[model samples]
Target: MMILVTGGARSGKSRHAEALIGDSSQVSVYRYLANP
Candidate 1:
């Protein structure tokens, strides 16, 4: 399974996502996207 978390810059989106997924024992893969 995959999850994509997004929000405006400096919106603490990543922190929110981490908290949501923090209790899982499964493997997680994170990918970061950059706009050019």
Candidate 2:
């Protein structure tokens, strides 16, 4: 599963991603990248 969230800092990106994930056991690895 893959999700792409693009927004400014502290814009609920992580929160939304967590909600989308929602206790899913399949998603074993998680990664985050920041670009300026």
What are the per-residue Cα lDDT tens digits for candidate 2 across 1-36?
A: 666877899898888777767777675455677776
lDDT for each candidate structure: 0.77, 0.74
Query: What is candidate 1's TM-score against the reference?
Result: 0.60
List the candidates' TM-scores in order. 0.60, 0.59
Estimate the TM-score for candidate 2. 0.59
For model 1, residues 1-36, the per-residue Cα lDDT tens digits are: 777899999888878778767866787766666679
Model 2 local distance difference test score: 0.74
* Model 1 worst lDDT run, 10 consecutive residues: 23-32
Deviation from native of the Cα of residue 33 in model 1, angstroms: 3.3
Model 1 accuracy (lDDT, Cα): 0.77
Number of the predicted model whose TM-score against the real structure is largest: 1
Error of 2 at 25 (Å): 6.8
